[model samples]
Structure formats: C-alpha cells, structure tokens
Target: MQDLTQAAALTGPAGGEPRLVAIPRLAAGGRWRVEAMRAISEPMLLWFTKGQGRITIAGVTRGYTAHNAVFIPAGVMHGFEVGPQVFGNALFFGKDCTLPLPQAPHLLRIREVHAQQEVNVIFDMILREMNSDSPAHERATRHYMGLLGVWLERQVAKAAPEQTRPDAAKRLVARYTALIERDFRTGAGVGEFAAALGVTPTHLSRCCRQACGRSAITILQDRRIFEARRLLAETRMPVGEIGASLGFTSAAYFTRAFQHLTGKSPTEFRRSV
Candidate 1:
C-alpha cells in the first residue's frame, strides 16, 4: 500500500459565503488530483470546461469530457483525476443556498449550445461576485446559484422524457435504480437485480438500456464503486476490511474490479488524489 502520510491536498473556500474558484488555482501547474475520495461537507459543483477524464461515483465510472458538470451533495464522498488541460470553476455553496437536488450524486453532460452559453454566463457572474469587495457579494452569489439550480433542473428534465419511454419500461428501470442504490454493497449482481424486479436478466438488460443508456449490471457496479472509493479515500481502513464491507469476496478481487472501472489501483489512487 502507498504511504498515507502524503495525503492529497484538500482546498476549498474558507468563509461563510458561496464562492467560485478556478480548478487550476486549487492544484498548481498542469496537475489535478483529489484521488482520495472524501465527502464534501458543503454542496459543491465542479463544472469542467476542457479536458477528458474518468469520474467514478457510486461505482459507476463515465468518461467526462468537456461541458460536464458534476453535482455532489453534501456528505456524498467523491474524487477526481482532472489535469491541467481542464478549465473550469468549482462552485462551493453553503447548505442554506444549496437548491433542492436529487438525493443521489448526479453527473450532467451539458450538450445544448445555447444552454451551455447560459451556464457560462452564470459562472462568470459567480466568479466576479466571489472575488468582489462589494457588501452584497454574498447575496449576489446566492442569486446566481438560484439561476444555476433552475438551469440544472431544466437540463435534467430535458434528458429523459416519459413520452419517449414505454410506461412499463420506465417503471421497471426506476425500481431497478432504487434497488441498486439500496443493495449495491451486498455484492448484488445483474441477475439479482433482475430477479428482484420480477424479470429475467435478459429482460432487465433490454429495459435498462432502453430507458437509461446503460445496462442494469453497470448501474449496480457503479454504486458499489462509488461507495468503495469513498471508503478508500476517507478512512485508513485496511483495504480488506473495506472490500469485505462492500461485499467483495476477496481483497485481490476487489482491487482488480476497482482498478478496472476507475483506471487506478485503490492504493495508488488514494495516495495520488
């Protein structure tokens, strides 16, 4: 295992007001690492402008390129592997200003050109207000945050429409999503998720793909990894204990699976971030 004394540098706003900070400022030069996964005590949004990298949450890893914004709720553990090419601002908001958000961590890919521009304006305003000497800076930032919340809600609503999916398929996948969130640490697999939903594994796969663009098994694995990353980064628990807690049969197997999806061994990753 890598040495634990050299932990990833953790940085954030140091006040009682909402704030925005450029990613490069947090990690100097062309490097970005928050590898040791840990929970954000406040609601934080990392909006990427350039570069591409993998982001794992709840065991689901996705290739996040440009124009991706990850909304992490307070208390949800997460990490990063962004580089210098990455250009964006990290918006940190107090719990009082955090808008109503989905209960789970959400990764949003903003593709619409006009919508992208709109968010950009809000980010600019936030940065300005965050660094300004005005007395209303806090209130102004909060107003901009509200706009952000609205835009994010609209984007989510636009991604999936009930009319586009068959009612039965929607219901099944919704239940499947919930089950994975609740039982992922149990080491449940695709077959089990299928069985619980009263459908065959093949049927589950088809429905999940049709409704969510990912397989049911993929969802379960992502949830497990999301929790695993948090445990590895936040605690000094022997990896074997973490693996066993997450329902991994063996430590070696856990390392392999975590590395496969996250692109780094748990030990190396925990230290790098």
Candidate 2:
C-alpha cells in the first residue's frame, strides 16, 4: 500500500498553475535532465521520430529507436538517454489532466507506416491547437490529448505479448522501485527497504543488479539525488532544508553526495541552473 503522506505529496503541482505543454525533445531540458531516474507530477508522452537510445521505466531498461512512442503516467519513475542525433517531441499532460491515461508505462514500437503517420498527425494537431489563438483552444487540446490516449490504447492492444513472464528478479526490483518512490524522502537506506520488502539487503541488491544492472543502494541514491536536483532547479527551497527533507543527515553530507552524483554542490547546482 502507498503511504498516505507520501502519496499526498505526489499529487498536484506544488507551485504555479497547471500546465499542458509540448516541446521538442532537445528543448525538454537537455540529456542529463532526461537520462536521470526521476518522477514528475504530470503524465508525459514521447514521440521519437529519429535516433535511438535506452530508456528505463518501472525499473526495466529497454532500447528505443525511431518511430517509437513511450507513454509514462504521472508519478512513475522514468528516464531516457538521447544522443545529439536523436529528435522528437515530448508532450507533457499537466497534473490536473482529466483525460483517462494508462496506469502503467508503455513503449510502443510503431512498425506500420500508416500507424506512424497517424501518430505524427495526432502530435501535429495537438501542437496546432496548443499554439492556436482559436476560441476554446484548451478544449481542443483536451480532445487531442484524448485522441493520443486512444492511439496508445490501440497500439498497446495490438502489440505482441512478451515472450517470457517477468522473472523473480524483475518482480522484486519493480517492488523495490515502487517503495523507493513511496518513501525515498524518509532517508531510508537499502537495508530498511530490503527489510520492508521481506528480503535481506544482500538478496535485494543482487536482484536489483540482475534486473537493472545497478545495485540497490545506487538506485536509492539516484532517486534521492533526482529529487534534490528538481528542488534545486524548480524552487527556492533552502539548501539545508532540501537535504533534510530528503532524509540527508547533514547539509555537508548532502552537498557531498549531490556533488558526487551530479558533479555540483547543492548551492553550485542551484546557481548554475
């Protein structure tokens, strides 16, 4: 079960108005911003028209190439690596979006030319309505969002099922990621998380490595660091408070960890951004 306190924190934009916006992949805050493991308050759709890279969602990593569409629901941990040759559009459906969306993440490899054209048309229409000064443009945008959802549904339904079921390692790692998303702010370490999941720290770490090629501790730290970066870039929260809120024992330690992972101290990161 999700902890109510943490789940509440996950809902709604903490600051500013809700936004439904679309921008090119390169404009979506660059590579590190997208390549790190993190969750956002809003759902997002990525339409990859060119290039290829790896993406991790729900603790599973997969390669993505051109004509691929990835849908990530709000509050789910996801990240992707895109190179200079990569090109695409990323559409963000705001926290307050009322349109029905898949509860899980999806990566649809669009093989049919007609299907690719259909998705392109939908994206084009969405961009058009968003940039238009036409009356009820917001409504038009909502309708287009619905169409995009429908497109995802059809593609997901048509896709072939996985050849093999999720193994024990994958299942355990998925659960571990879910718990990290739930209580990462509490500063719980790998042992505590493993205990809660009814496994020893060694076993959990082994499974995590088997599933995602990273140790359990590394995954937990990545999550915490991701939140630290978001707070530094998006808000005026004090450095000490941000670290404390993320369960860091001291400001100095937070700075060290942040610098080690991000190559910048908290203050320096804030300044650079």
Candidate 3:
C-alpha cells in the first residue's frame, strides 16, 4: 500500500489530461525501490515492458517479466521489487475514468497469448502518447485508457473463476467481508457478525480460517485499521475524532490497535506523513 499522497506530490499535481511518466531503462547495475508499499494507495493501471520482478500483494507473491500486465485494484496492499530492472509506464486516473469490473479488487494477471499482445500494444500506445507533443495528446491518452479498461474487463471475465466452492463456511466468510465493508462503523463484534451471517461464532472463525487465512475477528480488525490509516493519511481530522468515527469506544484503545497493526500511533503516522 504505497502512500499515494506522497507519490502525487513527487509527480506534481495531476495534469489536465492523463499524465505519463516514462521510467527509462534501468542503469546496468543500479537498483531502484520505486516507492514503499504504502505509497500505492489508489488503483493503478501498470504495464511492464522489459524486466523481471516480484510483486507482493495481500500476502500473495507473484513473479512477472516482460510482456506481463496487471491491474491492481485500489486499497489492496501491493508493491514490486524489480530484478533486471525494467522500463514501463503507469497511467493514473481519477475514479471518473475507471471502469467497473465484474469481480473487483482482485489482481487480473494476464496470461493468454493474444491478451498479452493486446497489453503490449497498450503499453506501446502509452509510450507514443508520452513522446508525442501534439495538441491532441490528452485525447489520445484518454482513448488508450478507455481501451485499457475494456481490455482489463475482458481479461477479468476470462480469468475469473466460474464458481468458487459453495461450502457454508466459505459463504459465511464472504458474507462477513461484505458486511464489514458496508457496516464496520456499526461497532459490530465477531458474534454479531456471525449471527447476522447465520452462523455460530465458532463456525465463523473456522470458515474465515479456511477461506481467508484469518479469523473473522482478525479480518474485522484489519479492516478497521486499514480505514484508520486511510483517514490518517488523507484527512486532517483529529485522532480522537477519527477513533470515534471508526466506532472505537475510546481513543486509547484505538491508539493501541492502530499501533499494533501499523507499528505507529495515529498521531505519529499523521505527523510523519
């Protein structure tokens, strides 16, 4: 989860049109840590043209090389460490330009031969748009972004699972995630979440372990912590107010939880950022 706020500052304010940043060929022996994991807080369309690299997202690691393209949804923790340093371009757009996906926030890894070709072309188009100084550059960039969105939708459609196992445990965990995303501010406990999902607390814990690799309570806490971080980085609200907003009964408890997950207190994080 890269801190998008800082990235935005480094890149300067958003231009009237899609701004293109060309990362030229890496120096023969130089290494670059483009940005910390926390710097990438927004959804980004990324294309890798020439390099081998490893990306870690949400505790899942994947290796990538030349001609590989990936769509990283917003708010999902992700960062890349490149090997054989590569060159690519990233097109950052606001929510208005982003297209909806059938299954959201899942990384769409492009693998099909034809689909890879299409992705390559999109990368090339981005390079062309960056190089061209024509008056129509913005229009060209927007068109290519639209094309990229459509391509992503197609790739997700092709790659997404037809159906996940319908075990009751899995369903229960899925329902819990949905509810947390929708109603975390309600201060609901694990037992309340299980009851709403029509499962016993013990069953919910087991289901979460099998499906999400964590207990229901852990997932809920993570979501709250994530939201707390988002506000700390994005808003000027006071720490106590933020705690109350997230349903924390006391600011001290919220501070402890935030420190446990982020290794920094809310005020510390906000000040450092």
Best by TM-score: 2
Q: Which stretches of candidate 1 lie over 4 Å from their true place?
A: 1-118, 132-136, 150-171, 210-214, 249-253, 259-265, 268-273
Which residue pairs collide, candidate 1?
35-273, 58-222, 58-223, 58-226, 59-222, 59-225, 59-226, 60-222
Clash number for each model: 8, 0, 8
**Superior by lDDT: candidate 2 or candidate 3:** 2
TM-score per model over all chains: 0.56, 0.90, 0.64
Alpha carbon lDDT of each predicted model: 0.69, 0.79, 0.62
Candidate 3, position 41, lDDT: 33
Off by over 4 Å in 3: 1-93, 98-109, 127-133, 160-168
lDDT of 1 at 230: 65
Residue pairs with backbone overlap in model 3? 1-37, 1-38, 2-37, 2-38, 2-39, 2-40, 3-38, 3-39
Sequence-dependent TM-score of model 2: 0.90
**Per-residue lDDT of 1-273 in model 1, one digit per residue for the tens?**
222223232222222456677866755421323543334457777888999776644333457878988887665544566666878888877755556755656778888899989999999988888788999987887788889988877776776563243378756766665555445566767887687678999998887677655676766676577667666766798888889987799999999999998889989877865
Pairs clashing within candidate 2: none
Give the Cα-based TM-score of candidate 3 against the true structure: 0.64
